[model samples]
Target: MRSPNPRILYTALCLTGLSLATSVIAQDSNEEVSRIEQVIVSASREPETGLNLTLPWSRIDDDALKLTGAVHINQVMQRAPGAWISRGNGQESLVALRSPVLTGSGGCGAFYTAWDGISLRAPGFCNVNQLFDVNSEQAGAIEVIRGPGTAVYGANAVHGVINTLTADPRQGPEHGYAVEAGPNDYYRVRGEFRAEHGAHAVGVHFNGVSDGGYKDNAGFDQQKLTLRHDFSGEQWQVTNALEATNLNQETSGFIRGFEAYKDPNLKKVNPNPEAYRDSFALRAYSRWSRETGAGQLSITPYFRRTSMEFLQHFLPWQATEKNGQESLGLRLALSDSIESFSWSTGVDIDATRGWLREVQDDDFSPNQPAGVHYDYEVDALSAALYGQANWQLTSRLGLAAGLRLEQNSYDYDNQTDDGSACAPEASACRFFRPADREDDFSNGSINLGVTYALSDDHRIYLRGAQGFRPPQAAELYRLQSGQEVADLDSETITSVDLGLRGAMGGFSYDASVYSMQKSDVIFQDADRQNVSGAKTRHVGIEFSVYWTGESGWYAGIDGNIARHRYDSDANLLGSRLDIEGNDIDTAPRHFGSARLGRDTALKSGRSLTTELGWVHMGSYYLEPDNQHEYEGHELLNLRLALALGKGFSTTVRVSNLLDEDYAERADFGFGAYRYFVGQPRGVFLEFAYSPE
Candidate 1:
């Protein structure tokens, strides 16, 4: 791998130090002092102030969500350090958190995604583009943990965790609505209603969107609905939530050639107009909690159903695949505190039934058949037991530790004739069907940390943790090149982090450095065989800082400098290559965003807010050989909002303000370069109304 870039690291460290120094100087000034403490729930599955948490995490609040008005989740996710949601054609994305943008059937298993503290999908049945199945567009808050979360979250928390919290009926206006319009014939409508009676409250939120897309024949229509009910009693509190989402999109395949995104005409062309994806998901859950003599007891049960159909345009055979899953799960927890010690313990249980089918219409070659490639069904069961505790040994020193044990089992049934799909005279087929079989995996994870308080508003912490993910169903059953069975071990990662976080005199900052090592990584070898026992290493420095002046001005910056490299010799593209120490493809060394804004109050109870944002993506190799590269790009964004008294407001946003040309993603595959052209400059306007 390439040597670490000192310039980039130095710049990020300087910014973080400046924010801390300014806080000290401002604290001594005569100006009014203000402090804010943000609350997060992803750390321990309970509301806790971020200032006191031992984890490295970030949150995007409702105010920021409203001001940004993101059509894509990537817009708001960029504000968090060490995070990158790689955007694809309309509503599709690949996630990278403290690691490279991993791709493949099992890549999505590295990160755990949830809604309202409930897992969105059952273990061993994850989809790479599953983020679109949630209603993040209208979430009350989005929280992200940058490193391993397995100790508290169980399996599939190898890289990190992201949780989207639903809007609470008691916190916002009673009735609200918004209408938005933008370039490319795009339109969206959003509405919400809340009602309270006695000790019961209900909230209904919904949104719909229609877009004419930037690339030819590439458009999408989507809808999302959420329902929340809450009941407060003397001894018990109950919260119920239901969420549903649907998406129908015409996808555009990658355009090939070097720097094709720079060509105006080529950038707008679609290579596969017939490529499309349709997906739907529904989830419901209820959480009940109360104070008890033993401890604070809580119980939660959830149900989920999801289905999807998409054309595999990236493959030469152009096969179509359909898949779905239905699951039921439950979570129970208890917590208590005595003296200077606090502790929590929990148990999780889940069961799911899933099925998949793939078919090709016409023959592409002798090795690629035209009939059904594979058809199979799987039943999965997962369970875990976990506990965590904290001890305040002294007024200034503390210690924390957690441990988890999880088991996952899968029962696979094949509905097709076993063996290769090609005829006997043909060479080994590219697709193979495995016989019916059963597989099971068990894994353990643990975390330990220590913290020391420097003063009333400052503290430092050091943490070490382990995480793991069982192989997905597809990776085991969807064999290739005559492989009869896949015997793969669970993937695991160990990470260590050192950090500091605090808030003082209207200034808040978080800075951390982390190193991680992964083992038993699953990937296809150069000879097209399923394999394991690979290894990789990751190291990075991440920071986020913000300053809000009493005069209604604020500035903030967040970013990371990191390197991801292979720790073992490997082969690539049918060639024997010594790839040890080489930088992983699509893994950028540095990327980040910065923002400057101010707010002013006008006469008649009106207000005005303006902000500008800068986003940077550093260069990285497009292939393992490190022979091809994509030079990075930067763009600017602007937003202005006007609040007209009496529950009326208007917002105008401009994306890609400088009209620069760039590619949202770049790749080298099939012996050619491919790019997903970024959208051109766009202007969006929205009008909203809410009654007081």
Candidate 2:
């Protein structure tokens, strides 16, 4: 894999300009662009607006996102309530929604990330950095379902769900293009086109970015394209979406030592400069809807193909890992209204085939082998059925209940027997890979809620739900020397939530408190063996409030304060260790952000907007033992934009304005403290054009 050179990036920008010019030639047909509005979220699996939602949620509209200057998911998610998106090396991130910044092979399966209501990867093959597959930078809206999602989403919806939607073509015919340049020789080009003719509509988007990076040999280049089409008939409609993505990343491993992020020299040096990751994905899905006697019915069918290869620089013995998967899935649902109740039912099915291979190329210890350590293939099948009903119990009271049953099965085939050994040169080994095996799990989820409307603009609700997820393929197949087989159960959580949500005049607010208990938690023991059947507890309060006055001023604050702790004792090495009531690692107790901005009208139908934002994170333990902790930091950001005309705009953004040195992520493992250094103070300029 190779990063794009300066000349290539320049050529790419020039081609984008040519495309924009070509789109302008179709102006013979005059059209008026409609104003953008906040959309009702479909991820809720119900027909409800944000103001009427009983569950804790958040939405980032196009207007607020403009002031963010967001290039990464972390930048935008920070504005949401109880959400923490941490960035690693180039385009890599981990999400935390009412949970911790989960790590390890099992981390990716704890949250569900989707594009247009479709999962990025199959259940067992989830990538931790799956967000890179979606073009969120150009999305129409980003919806977040905090805590356990609706029953219709099924597995991997434990902590929360993120769904990104593409712009609708009905708002066209419209064309948009943007060019951005910033510190570290960064450059990006983006373009979009939407048009509608009679009953058919089409939308297309393209994005590309290249950066020289701040650390040595740490650079990346990425590109993505999405195409969508919609066709409507008298009583039936069909929508199709297709996307292709490619990424080449030169990864930078963490720097070791306490407070190492403050060292300017160390922050610029890449400890593992040879690390790189290259990946590609192609996904397509179609949704069909028709009017039925009972109500409206919809069916969706999807296909996915993805492949990736990366170097394991964090491990002492560097290994080259490769994996790929192909899947076919279908979802069906129906909704109708009864006398006083609204109900919906759905079913989901999926089948996938995948393979994984790992080989050690650089051995730092003589005890570790230098040959192929793992090679396997797996076939996975999953199915689920769910139903939900909402009833108006009284003039001002409502009740909602839902139930879901799901099953997952995996068939594994091991192609190598030398996966582990008592010695690196041993003739045979018996520790890591066991004989071919089949594992299956059956789980269920339940959701119940009650709501009372105190007035037209005030409401309160109570909700209790259960969520579960089956074990991931890596947790079962990626074996260490101490174990011959992994016997794990599905992780489950039970939570109770109480909240108030509503809009009054020019003010809107959402606040909630939740208590949860998780069973069968998966983790690595002191013996360095993977196991399940542990327990944990979580409790938190999160809220968001925004006020917009007629004086053109607006302000809002959103944040979460939480505690997560282990509630079980364990057998470590050989002796029993009492770890009850210990705080969970990487889970901060307090974190949130605030923003203040204003919009002013200028001369001749123009306007100017500016925003000032602040972010704060509290200190937290870096290890399960609760002996090591990281001191968190606060940050400030500024953004200013001017509308040049009806079709053009310009913006100036400054990040880390105080130039404070900090760590984006911190951890203690392998007998040392490691950190991913955060970016320093940087200035960026942006120019955009959107014709009406």
Q: How many clashes (backbone atoms < 3 Å, residues ≥3 apart in a chain or on different chains) does model 2 have?
A: 0
Q: lDDT (CA) for every model shown?
A: 0.88, 0.80
Q: Write the per-residue lDDT of candidate 1 for residues 407-496, one digit (tens) a residue.
A: 999999999989898888778789899999999999999999998888867879999999999999999999988899999999999999
Best by lDDT: 1
Q: Positional deviation of 96 in candidate 2, in angstroms?
A: 1.1
Best by TM-score: 1
- Measured against the true structure, the TM-scores of the candidates, in listed sequence, are 0.96, 0.92
TM value for model 1: 0.96
